[model samples]
Target: MLKILPAKEIYLQGNEHAVLLLHSFTSHTRDMKKVATSLHAQGYTCYAPLYRGHGHTPEQLLHYQVDDWWQDVVDAHQFLLNEGYQKISVIGLSIGGIFTLKLAQFEKLSQIIVLSVPIDKEPAQLKQRIIDYAYNYKTIEGKSASQISQEMEPFHHMALDAMSAFQQFIQATMQQLDRITVPIAIYYGERDDASYAQSAETIYQHVHSSTKQKRGFENAKHLMTLGRDQDEIIQEIIDFLE
Candidate 1:
């Protein structure tokens, strides 16, 4: 376990094939450890990296946006490449998954598996935002606006201009999908809050990779790999990489 200031480095067990695990927005690398463990137990070295402002405090991520994340993924790539690993595979959860695909649009990777990616940033897509505005500082029962404050904690007071940049990122990448020639697999939960119900299907239809797929699990939430039967999801990833 290596905490490199901005990026926490947790090396999974195996030393053979390497896989990089990037976590979601408003989250640290803690959860990816589950997938990393499975991959490592199967003899693949795994790198679970924490982003610049994530997994630290909500304030850390408030100012940072999606571009910051893309850079981190590339930094992780350089780190892994420097470690002498070839034929790398990347697996990411939620926003991390989108970052993985963003990287795939340009970088060369053995394969990329994206879970719960935000293909679009519709207001309906983020339930948290709706809840925040609807309640308007009102304390909630199941969860309060303050409880959900982490959603905007890092960028709370800012202008939220980060979204426009993310829009550009999506617009640029979606048009250049054909440029991504690597094997890509996407996994999403049927009950994901970040996506419209048909997100997985939409990705399958629009993405340009010849080797791509979409699999949605019943009752799986946005954090599908961390939900029930998470191991089975990791197994699907293992099979994909194998």
Candidate 2:
């Protein structure tokens, strides 16, 4: 049986490395349970740290910024280290993927994976994708933008204090991509309008990591984690990790 742990406790697997599954922006750890379960079955202890502003109501997300999200990963990493798991792997989707890319370069983990990472939450050339993400985010299941925005407005944009931090997040990750020597995998959909594949392409090229792979689903969109393509995507992840 799968052992699910609360955010307050560390779930350890004796004699095994730990893997972290980080959820996307505005999502709770529940979103990662499937992926975490897959890794958990592979003899790895997996934990999904709830992003500060996410998993809660919209009111909670507005209070978060990228830095706050980074801190969550840092804490999770330390938690696993303290648990006696000397090796680690990290996998993240969307905004969580952004932090994973940032962490991969320096966390010195065993492996790293990103799924449609939110390299640009602003969705620059991918404006349509942002609209879709935001729209589906709140509008999904009949929730409206106003309803979601009212709750997410304060955090609708990068917090003022974290603008520089986000900038550095991009810069530092770029400069240190060559410093990363672990196995890295980039997963995304070819049809995704939310996150540009260029970001992943850049990583595949610049990162010094010798074992890096980028896999794409031709029919999948940005929410590659939860769509018809999920099976293929999950299988790809399993193959790559193994």
> Deviation in angstroms for 232 in model 1?
1.3
Q: Report the C-alpha lDDT of model 1 over 100-145, residue by residue, as the tens digit.
A: 7777877788999988877676423333442343234223223545
Question: What TM-score do all the candidates reach, one by one?
Answer: 0.80, 0.78
Q: Cα RMSD for candidate 1?
A: 5.5
Model 2 lDDT at residue 122: 33
Query: Could you say which candidate leads in TM-score?
Result: 1
Clashing pairs in 1: 62-154, 62-155
Q: How displaced is residue 211 in candidate 2, in Å?
A: 1.3
lDDT of 2 by residue, 1-242 (tens): 22223333225353377788877655567657777677667777887788675543344444556677789889988888887778888888877777787777667788888888644433232323333455555554466556666644444453444554565575655666677778989888789863458877877888788888987788888767777788778778777777
